[model samples]
Target: MNKLRIGAATAAVLLALGTAAWSLRASGAGHTDASAPAPSVLTVEVIVPQQQSWPQSVQASGSITPWQEIIVSPETGGLRIAELLVDVGAVVKRGQLLARLADDSLQADLRKQQAAVAQAQANLYQAMSNLQRARMVDGSGALSAQKMEEYRIAEATSRASLDSARADLDSTRLKLSQTRIVAVDDGVVSSKSGVLGNVVAAGTELYRLVRQGKVEWRPELDARQVSTVHTGQSARLTLPGGEQVAGQVRLVAPTLSATTGRATVYVSLPAGAARAGMFANGTIELGAQPALTLPQSAIVMRDGRAYVYLVGSGSQVTSRAVSTGRRHGDRIEVLSGVDASARVVASGGAFLSDGARVTVASVGSAS
Candidate 1:
């Protein structure tokens, strides 16, 4: 009976030990699975804030236009256009012939005037000869006083006719020269309204030119913002196709727009493939400023508010609201609400929430 009791107690003890070992193994497995971070939670790119010298700029949108658009018109009327020498978008120099008119009728009038001048000269010679004979014979009564006076009048009348004919000839020559329409300044032809065989009138617009191939960026800004811009300030423009153009502020409008109450800012750009009437948005750099900035992709705009995710211990991310200012390209300046040393999820902040767990794929600084 004593042996049976001892064996039974030993078996019970062994069974208890086996159960405890099994529970320990199970607990270890459960702890390992619970502690391990899931692979599919979320991955994000992280960045640290950097100190940079960023340019202070004014932002606006406007059209690229000509510095000066000169309208070329006809000075002489009633002539058919015989030739077109330039087309739209053609580059031309000052005094370049842009078009020519038919000169057949003009030449005919010139010839007629020349013939009249010749006839007047011949008449003047005859009258002068008569006047001389009358004066010589006046000593005798053969030439009366009335006849000499008439000879004097005839000489004067012929001389007057000769002067008038010469004046007419000069007028005809001037008219003939006007048959050619020339450029008044070096420019690019922006528009051409005249056609071959079409008769144009005086004061009729034939071509519109962009004088000197110079372009300007005219941005309309509010009155408060316009005061910040001035001549000689440098600017940069970005086209829709992602091309960048540099320019300088040339003028600030003295008056405000009546409808929009916005002031105009004119920025002159260098000669290039930039065309007038191109719509572009750009910034006029006021100067460089010390700032803490981050990549634009790092900011998450929600409900009209901008937010960023700050990295915490154990790959946790916290939502942080930041004040942004002076944005350029893909980088944005942080005005406040973030520390310079804080590591932020540069991108994929939209996929994260406050205290969200994440795995960082890359770490860098966006200055």
Candidate 2:
């Protein structure tokens, strides 16, 4: 009876142990089902390249210069500059007095000329009276024919002397007018070389003027670029001080430079827009044409080449290398490599890799 009782107890213990082991296994399975992770899907935005009319342009760099520089010089020689009126950067009008030469000697010569003119007039009047009197007495036998002929000859001589004196007076007046130096055109004085009390020679440069105060940008371009540029095209430039200026193509060089193999394009800027001798970088607008372009944010640079991310089947992003061209605003031209049908990741491409699956938040919106 003791052995049977012990065997029954053992069987009951084994059953209890088996039941507890099964319960523990069930709890572990439930915990595992609750804690297992889901697969990751990166949220992103995608865009489709569109065909839009974008301006065609060429990048150019060159210098700002005067459209027409006028060298101001004195026409008369051997005169001292008595007064300096206009200086550098002075705005002047046509025929405005720029400087005055020492005119004390000229004034004296003018007074002497006036006296000679008066004397000439008196002599001419006397000659005319004598001639009239000689004609009246002719053939009246009041005077001999020889004496009448002599009087006529004297009158002619006096008339010639008066004419010569008058000519001298007119020449003196012209010299006096030259003492006052005047501007040849309306312009802004760019430089001044004349000084007060300095003697000047004929054709001596006194000042430099920017004709009409006009300036132009001369951009050097290669042969291929020069071929496309035409008069009347629009241009936009950035000045040295970061100022923006607008200009229009005035002329294209007729010939290319033999040394540099480049051509100069003249772009006329508005007055006060820029100054001569300023270095500028600018672009010439050729015109507009349809182009396949994507937002600049869609582009990525990798391994020194431009690339874009294209969303493929299964929402997977693939890296695509692209050839880019002109950029306008936030959009960049896709010269080749990608087409309009490809869906590109607008932004956050730096965070992604090839074959990466993404959950697109919105179309045509940046991440």
Candidate 3:
């Protein structure tokens, strides 16, 4: 009976061991299947390039100034300022009276000149009569030759004196006419340096005139940028209040400033609107060129280098180092690295690794 029990126990032990081995094998297989990486599911954005027209533009800043400026000064000296006709900020026409010198002394001098002229005329008439009388007497032999010669000499002297006096009178009259100050151009008076009752010297600046109510914007551009700007290019002016005025590039300096590496760009504003010394900003368009562009978010920086992930055949991710150009709005220009026909990942590119399989969630449309 003991041998029978031991045999039954041995048989039971073997059967239990076999069942445990089978169960362990099944669980190992299940774990192995669960650990095996299913194809990495990656979310990506794909972009296909399309050919389109793009414009290249350059931007710069500048200020506004008067197109022309003139300083009005006195032409003659030693005149007391009698009346000021125009004040600062006053609009004036060409040849309009701006001021007047004290004319009391000038008027007296003018009268003196007129009297001198009348006296010269009377003297000339007397000389003519004396010459005629002397000739008649000499012809009739009633007067000696020496006496006729003396009378002729006296008449010639009187005639020369009369001509000299007339010339002096005309000069004085011209000087008298210059005492009134007049505007040299059609403009506004920007400054006034003289006042009534003040004595001024010749050529002293009495008023400042800004011509034609126009202004010039002189923008400094770098030497490289100077070549892009040209005369007659369209320009727009921005003021402090965001007001914009249309203008045109009128002049470009041929030389560059050595100190600043810049050249002057001149723009002309319309009349009766822009004033001198007003601050202004402007922009000018250079020509256009072909370029490949991508959104700023599409570029990825890795290990101190700029790169972008490209989608290959079957949505495989590949990183490519790229050279970029200027930024246009939210997009940047691609100078090199990616070809036009390739699909580029636009978003979620940083999470991608080389040769990683990806599934594109959205395809970007070309602009």
Q: Rate the local accuracy (lDDT) of all candidates.
A: 0.89, 0.88, 0.81
Worst 10 residues of 1 by lDDT: 37-46
Write model 1 residue lDDT over 1-367, tens digit each, in one string. 9999999999999999999999999999999999887553688878998788977788899999999998987778998989889999899999999988899998999999999999999999999999998888899899778889999999999999999999999999998998888999999999989878988888888899999999999989998889888889999999778999899999999999899999989999998648898999998888888989898888999999889899888888888899998777888889997988889888877887887789889888764
Lowest-sum lDDT 10-residue window in model 2: 36-45
Ranking by lDDT: 1, 2, 3
Which ranges of candidate 2 are over 4 A from the true structure? 1-41, 126-160, 348-357, 360-362, 365-367
Best by lDDT: 1
State how far residue 26 of model 1 sits from its true place (Å).
24
Candidate 3, after superposition: displacement of residue 255 in Å?
2.2
For all candidates, what are the clash counts?
0, 0, 1
Report clash pairs, candidate 2.
none
Task: Please report the candidate that would top TM-score against the real structure.
Answer: 3
Give the TM-scores of the predictions, in the order they appear: 0.65, 0.77, 0.81
Across residues 1-367, which tens digit of lDDT does each residue of candidate 2 receive? 9999999999999999999999999999999988964343578887888888888899999999999988887778889988889889999999999888887887898898889878877887887798788788677888888888777887888788888888888888888899888988999999998877889998888899999999999999999999999999999999999999999999999999999999999999999999999999999999999988888888998889999998887788899999998787888889999887788888889888988888888887221
In terms of lDDT, which candidate is stronger, 2 or 3? 2
Stretches > 4 Å off in candidate 3:
1-42, 50-53, 141-167, 272-274, 278-281, 301-306, 350-353, 361-365
Query: In candidate 3, what are the lDDT values of residues 258-358, reduced to their tens digit?
Result: 89889999988787556677777767766567778888788898888789888877778889999987777877788888878778888777888899888
